[model samples]
Target: MADIAVSTRGLVKIYSNTVKALDGVSINVNHGEIFAVLGPNGAGKTTLMRILTTQLRPTSGEAYVLGYNVVSDGDKVRRFIGYVPQEFSVWTDLSGYENLLIYAKIYGVPRHEINERINEVLRFMDLSDASKRLVRTYSGGMIRRLEIATALLIEPEILFLDEPTIGLDPAARKMVWDKLTALNKELGLTIFFNSHYMDEVEMYADRLVILNKGKVVVEGAADELKRSVGGEVVELTVDDMSKTVHRVNEMNSLGIRDVNIDNDRGIVRVIVDNAEEALPVIITTLRDAGVRIIKASISRPTLDDVFLKYVGGKISEEGRLQEVRTLRSVIKKG
Candidate 1:
């Protein structure tokens, strides 16, 4: 328990007696590790982050951050942790240096050490050259880094980031993650984040928990979760969907139990123990069955595949939009 950075027991959050925002959720995150809470839109990721950050209360159950109870010991918990919410929390009218300075003063950093801390955070966030520029003038990624730098001015033991890289371009997202990774490694700071980006979670999170409809559906290291869904995925683009489906059905005899056929795209995705060994045999079988293969590739199972297995769907942009519509409908009915 002492080594655990965060722990929750049967957590639940109900909104207006109609919606169960969190349903008996429980998880543990180890110290000095980057832990990710992942889920689709409206999956209570934000609710959980707010609860852990002492901004919201759970209807039932308990949450501890760095061994401090989030509810009863919120003040102590605040002292030990920093939080960056989904929205940009910065003074856009003020310079980056001024923003950090204000935060340092608010966090009660010693007057003598305020400038030193500001300079340190600016350098760490790679914003030293732009420290005197108004935050409004910064790029989206730079604004995010500035926000993070403000959070770090307090030198908290753990950091909580909610959708930290949500709307940035690929390059900007990578830059933000680079700083986070460095902070975790160099300072041994425990980082807990809520993210929908599977690739980012796969790359940075030491472990992750996937929540759906207010409950955890799966939790593990990225590789462990991927393996749980099965092994490598052998994808083939075939010219004849019917013949390919028939030949793939025969693959069941070869111990390949998980096979998916996308007739629309003429893609066959097969889950096997080893794709490298299975690909040749599969191609030969298809060829012998008079099936023409247009293209074939083998890839290890991805986090998106893991999500699809547990959530029963892809968490794409369209899925997020659907979630929003569904939530609105429920709220209207309530």
Candidate 2:
């Protein structure tokens, strides 16, 4: 087995002369590692996924999946990788067992191994009881797991999952993550998947590739990415009659990460590299400026802070992390 499972150099893909699905993209996924590509909708994640699965050809540049060129050796490449598409690709009318049997036969899985593989995967998914149930009758989350189990039937060397838990509830999402982790760690399988949930990725990915507008923004360990945020946010409530703008700029000039204000609420949000060193300074600075401070504190930089820096940063939106909002602006709490 190769140390690098997938490698791309200056990969480019264009369609309809107006959209750049993937452009100048380069990335590496190490063998036996879980690499996650996370991005919002229409950010070219699907484009890259399609190309990697050898279903679509790139406009230019080169990509290799499992030592086989994605374009030239697509058949060989497809054999070694199993992909669970975002859409439900299995036959809903068929039972889980029937669906897996058809795929195994199509993949040329040896007849002797088919029964064992199907049984093993069904048990692995904790869906042995539902093996005979119609896929259409299964819940959204259970169907998702069945899809993954179908991919695992081939015992593929590399697995690619796209938004595997998109519509799943918390418990099902966690069960899927736990299964992926077991496969990646205990079984030493290389898994490449895409998702928008920071909490989910933070749990499973050994490394991450973040994409924005058909381009990769950053790739690194989660801790290092979070460390880049540096410090905590000091949320200050100001009751000054007229000194808000002057105060916000003054705080921003201190090499602080950012400054945001809820003008409607008189709260100034400050991001600093070192919260301990900066929070007292801000409190004293504002007091010295004759501004009254209602409150001040320091905290941790969450995964959304990282997302806001990389994904939302490209769109020029205020990284206001609240709870349970749109996927692009994830719900990050203080």
Candidate 3:
């Protein structure tokens, strides 16, 4: 536990005595790592961030950040962490320099060192040229970077970002991530963020936790999580849908246990230990059974597949809707 930057045990949060926002959630985030918290909307991702950031308290259980208890030592925790919420936290009317200056003073930076630190952060965020411009004139990505720059004024050891790139275009998102990466590498900052974007997590996160229904369904390095789902995925396109389904079911007898059929798309997804060996048998069986094989391909498991395997559903807008409905039903029954 000495190297752990954040830790929680039996964390639980309930609202209005009916809804359980966090249910026995527990996790460990190691020091100096980019750790990601991922879940569908309303999956307690933000709730966990709030608790750890000392903005909200859990109904029960304990949490610690940077060796300080979040609840009992909130002041100390605030000193060691910087938080960037999903929404912009900057003053639109203020120039970027003034914004940083205000936050630096609020953080109690030495008066003589205030301008020095502000200029350092502005250059670090690549906003030095635009620092004099009013934030209202900045682009979406520029605004995000300014927010991050403000958070850095205190030189926090651990930075918390909630959906940092939610609405930015691809280029803008990349720019934000690039600044984060630089901070992590150059300054040894620990980054803890919650993101709905799987690609970002896969690319930048050193480790991650997937929470569902207020519980940690899975936690590990992205590569390890993907491997846990099994090996390569074999997607088969067949002419006869029903026949293909029947043939795929027969594969169960051959110890191919994970097969999914999408009748609407005329495709069967098979999870196999070794695609090279399994592909031959699969094709032979389908052909012999008079099922026309139109195409077949093998691919490595993606983060989406890993999410589906554990979450038991696709990770999409519709999936979040379903989760909300399920939560409401449970609350009503309770």
Cα lDDT tens digits, model 2, 1-334, are 6899999999998764445678799999999989899877666787898999998899998999988999989989978888999988899999999999999999899999999999999999889999998998998878988999989877889999988888889998888888888988888889999888888888788889888767898998778887886577766777873475467566665668766554445566577877778877787887888888887766687666677666655352232221113332332321
What TM-score would you give candidate 3 relative to the actual structure?
0.89
lDDT (tens digit, per residue) of candidate 1 on 217-269:
99999999998879888889888876776777777655574776644455777
Clashes of 1: 0
Q: Relative to the unseen true structure, what is the C-alpha lDDT of residue 161 in candidate 2, on a scale of 0 to 100?
A: 94
Q: What are the RMSDs of all candidates, in order?
A: 3.0, 6.7, 3.4
* Highest-lDDT candidate: 1
Tens digit of per-residue lDDT, candidate 3, span 128-196: 999999999999999999999989988899999999999999999999999999899988899999987
| lDDT score, candidate 2, position 189 | 86
Candidate 3 residue-wise lDDT at 26: 93
- Candidate 3 at 104: error in angstroms? 1.3
Point out the higher-scoring one by lDDT: 2 or 3: 3
Candidate-wise lDDT, in order:
0.88, 0.81, 0.88
